[model samples]
Target: MSATDPPPKRRASIGARRNPASQAAILAAARAVLAEQGYSGFSIDAVSRRAGAGKPTIYRWWKSRAELLIEVYAAEKGALRAATTGNLAEDLTAYTAALWDFWRDTPSGRTFRALVAEAQHDETALEALRGKFLPERLQDVRALFGAAVARGEIAAAEVEMRLALYVGFNWYYVLTDRLVDGRAAIPAAMRLVAASLRD
Candidate 1:
């Protein structure tokens, strides 16, 4: 009440402290919309309606629909992390198998494929795909490869080249009708990939 007293502390901006519940709702609604309608019908408006959150709230967390989709994919995929077992072949086998299962079995897997399709002509979407999503995933693979090299299981010079080959092999399955039918073939694929990278 004193004149010298500062005004009561103002509440911090909503943007400063994001509610986990709001994020969960938005992401869940995003996945549901993406699943039911695919990328063609996904929008901030649709998600806001479904999540009971405002458009500004969604935008506060994500810059664009594609960025939001990336979060949904990451959430569904969970960290893209793998533990190195000090054996290159074993490590590659496990990572490859897990990656394959993700793209082959999950709804978000299909949503990712649809996003890939959408990105072919949409520049913003493609930028998000290449600049954000792919780099995030590549970093994980790079770490896995780095660990193998540290243990002297694979050569130092082959990491990037090997990563391309590994990802391209899986991408081929995403583009073809070879995913499920190709599961039986992954161990062989991993062996070949490991052998190619071995000193």
Candidate 2:
């Protein structure tokens, strides 16, 4: 309580000690487990041991494995990142590049694929994927498409269709034989998406 006492560290949540180092360690450990085991197989016990924290400490912070996975996802998934440069092509390129880069990195890439497969059977997981992971990326793309529509470079009517097409085409390559290695498909994806949105 003395003035000489060092000011407290920045607090993130409403009621928790805010030590950046601890949080980073926990998150890093969680990511390693998520990447290695996927969300379904991951557990707080393993995460605690890996994080060098106690079970109570982990439980004190995260209510459930789902909550842990949620944080793991937000921190790991770069696909949710977006750009708004006022140029549609640049915007899409930036978004897709970030996405491909994230996917190419083994940490998030393997986990994301597992998440997709998990979503196929789990309703709650599917909801989280759509509401939390999928829409964030889609929103940015929609905004870029809307900008192009405003500029008269593309029709507003085809925005949703184009986004869906882009996703479908890109995912097609990832799912089939891992052949979409950005060799001839990345720019082609950009081109196909751009053309699909054209007036």
Q: lDDT of all the models against the reference?
A: 0.78, 0.67
C-alpha lDDT (0 to 100) for residue 175 of candidate 1: 74
Candidate 2 local lDDT, 75-170, one digit each (tens): 666436676666666677777776666665656565666666677888866777776667754666777888888877678788878888778865
In terms of TM-score, how similar is model 2 to the real structure?
Answer: 0.67
The per-prediction tally of clashing pairs is 0, 0
Candidate 2, residue 56: lDDT: 66
Clashing pairs in 2: none
For candidate 2, which ten residues in a row score worst on lDDT?
7-16
Model 2, residue 146: displacement in angstroms?
3.1
lDDT of 1 by residue, 9-66 (tens): 2222378468887777778889888887776788898888777788877887788898
Pairs clashing within candidate 1? none
Candidate 2 wrongly placed segments (more than 4 Å): 1-25, 35-41, 52-67, 77-94, 177-183, 196-199
The ten-residue window of minimal lDDT in model 1 covers 5-14
